[model samples]
Target: MDPTLAIPLLGGLSPAAFMRRHWQKKPCLIRQAIPGVKPPLSRTELFALAERDDVETRLMLQRQGAWELRHGPFTRRQIPALNQPGWTLLIQGLDLQVPAAHALLQQFRFVPEARLDDLMISYASDGGGVGAHLDSYDVFLLQVSGRRRWRVGPVKDATLVPDMPVKLLANFEPTEEWVLEPGDMLYLPPRWGHDGVAEGPDCMTCSIGFRTPTPTEMAREVLQRMIDALEAPEKEPHYRDPAQTATATPGLIPEALQTFTQKAVIAALNDSRSLACALGETLTEPKAIVWFEGGEALAPGQGLRLDMRSKMMYDADHVFINGESFRAAGRDARLMRQLADQRALSAQECAGLSPGARELVEEWALSGWMHGV
Candidate 1:
């Protein structure tokens, strides 16, 4: 997309302008972000998806001024009747299951792929809502069908209601409000409090969320990957104390041992591009529950595309896919980075890969991390 072109998706602002003004800064309500936008799946289709074990689904009900929530692999009969009110069904990772939803996500690629996360769809009945809450990640709430009345604001008080299964705000104050209709959208930055209620039956909203990793969580992943990449010691080295000196305090850790442990960790990090390689692998690692089905080998002259479920990324010296990393440079490095950026390679582009790169591509294809275009 042209960075300077005014986009309806960003409320008539250019992508560059929107990113500068709204992204992670404040909220933006765009009317007709997608003119005449319809729900990607019908009620029945969405319900069927919720029934799948692979899908992450949730059901929330508000009855008699009380809240109840449940995880789902629910059947149609398990869901409330269409005539029912005050209930909502939330299906996470809709982009992984619906091609239309996935295509819709491409529009938001202005954000880096590393930060862009999955799309979630919520189906609600009349008077239904998930309750007043805040998220740690930024989100775009798009009304796909019917109408949702939203009350949103920055919350200073982040306390939650006790004993609630969901993290709901104990006290919420709205500074802005709007009733979003089909094709309307609202963008909320991380930690902004918001609540939406279905104005009528058949309310469906698509939530586009970004990944916000905590520093500690990211450090753990990167460190674990770095450890995995490190070579094993040739022999188990025992702690040594050739000097005839004993610790005055038996419970105290020896200063020599502390220094040795620090040196070992630093040495692992000092290994050739180990930190960079680890970051790439960690970033491209797929969810634990995600699995790929093997496919037939690639044929000659076929184009290629990364599987929707696969995560592919590259650093300066290495390419990473589905938690695996490979050293790459020269023409191969350039071609692989192009594939990572575009998420696909044309037949002509494929022709330019080195023999080894081609073999690697075929390997990924056989493993179902990518497919023939």
Candidate 2:
């Protein structure tokens, strides 16, 4: 995808321009963004996905001003009747299960892959809604079918309603309002308050959300990965106090030990490249519930593509796939980065890899992180 090329997906704003003007900055609503777009999955298909144990789903109902929530591997009987008012079924990570959903997600390649998350679908009955709420990540809400009424604004009060199963604003004020039809879309930055209600039965919306890791969360994740990736030294170093003096306070941390601890951590962090490697690996780590079945190795001269569920990324000196990091350079590095960016390699590109790199590709294929194209 060309970042500079304007597209209907962004209301004729190029990806580069959208990133500059709207991304994480404010909201942009576009009518007919997809123009004649249809829901990727039918109502029956979506309900079936919600029945699978591996899929994350939720059911919400608001009846007579009372809100109720339920978790699912829900059956059709468990779902509210079609004519029921103020009820909704939400399915998370649709892109992980459906190829068409994944293809729809790929249209937003303007964002970096590390920040790209997953697509969620919400199917709502008339008057259905999750209530007013704020999210800590960027989102694009696209109307897939029927109609939805949206009220959105910058959040001033961070207060939440008491004792609710879902986080809902105690006081929500709408600065703007719109009724969206099929193919309409709204882009919102993190922490913006929004409430959406279905106008009629069969209201379906697709939410393309991006990952937004807080500083503490990011540090804890990457630091833990770095610690796990540490290699054992040839010889274990022991602390010694050859010039020790007897201390009256045995409970106190010794100054020498404190200095030694700091030095040890500093030494580990001194290897600057390790942090980069750790970050790459962390960014590409697969979802907790995702698992791959092993398969046969790739045949020679075959084209290759990443599995739909695979998470692949790269930094300056390392390529990361399925939470594993590899050092890459020269022609191999170039080819690997291309594979990461394009998610596929042509047969000619595969043929150009060195013997070792080719073997590595086969290993990935066998592990089911990628497949023959």
Candidate 3:
């Protein structure tokens, strides 16, 4: 997508202008963002997916002024009747499981893939909702079926109802409200309080959410992955106080040992290339629930495309995919980064790979990270 190209998806704002004016700052509603869009999965298909043990799903209801929440692998009987009111089904990570969902997610790639998370579908019966709540991440909610009335605003009081199964705002004050019809979309920045209730039956909304890991959260993840880059601690001497003076405080940690630990950590942190590789690997790591099917190596004439389940990213000197990192340079680096950016490479591009890189890609194909196209 061109940064300067005006698009209906952002209410006629160019990608650059949208990012500058609205992204992470305020709410945006686009009428018919996707004109005449069909639901990614039909009602029956969504229900079937909800029944799969491998898929993450939830059922919620608002009955008699009480909210109910349930996890699924649901039987058809577990679902509310179509004509019923105040019930919703949520299926998480639809992009990880369905091609159509993945395609829908790609439309928002004007935002970097590192921040892009997954598409989640909410299917609701008449009058249904999960209740007013605030989210820590940004989201684009696109109505795909029926209609939903949305009430959204900046959160002033973050108080929640005590001991509830899900977070429900106790003092939600909506400054803006809209009824989103099929093909309509709304964008909300992080921590904005919002609620949506189905206007009628068969309401479905696709949420394209973005991850916003805090500094501490990101540090924890990067440090854990960075451990793989650290030098072997076995090479360091065991703690010894050969010349120690007898002290009454035996429980106290020795200053020498603390110095040794600090030195070891500092040495590890000094390896900038390793640090970059670790960060890339961490960012590209697939979710625990994601699994890929094994396949044979790529054939001679075939192009290559990443599996939907695979996450690929790159930094200055490394290419990372599916939690594994590799050093990349020159022509190999250029093409590998291209593959990560475009999610596929043509036969000509594949032919340009160095013999070592080609063999590595073949191994990835055999492991089902990417497949012959």
* Highest lDDT model number: 2
Question: Which is the winner by lDDT between candidate 2 and candidate 3?
Answer: 2
Best of the candidates, TM-score: 2
Higher-TM-score candidate among 2 and 3? 2
Lowest lDDT block of 10, candidate 2: 294-303
TM-score, candidate number 1: 0.95
Report every candidate's CA lDDT.
0.91, 0.93, 0.92
lDDT of 1: 0.91
List runs of model 1 lying over 4 Å from the truth.
Answer: 233-239, 246-251, 270-272
lDDT by residue for model 1 (145-193), tens? 9999999999999999999889999999999999999999999999999
List RMSD in Å for every model shown: 1.8, 1.1, 1.7
Please give, for residues 321-349, the per-residue lDDT of candidate 3 as tens digits: 98889999999999999998889999999
Instruction: In angstroms, give how far residue 349 of model 3 lies from its true place.
Output: 0.9
What root-mean-square deviation over C-alphas does model 1 reach? 1.8
lDDT of 2: 0.93
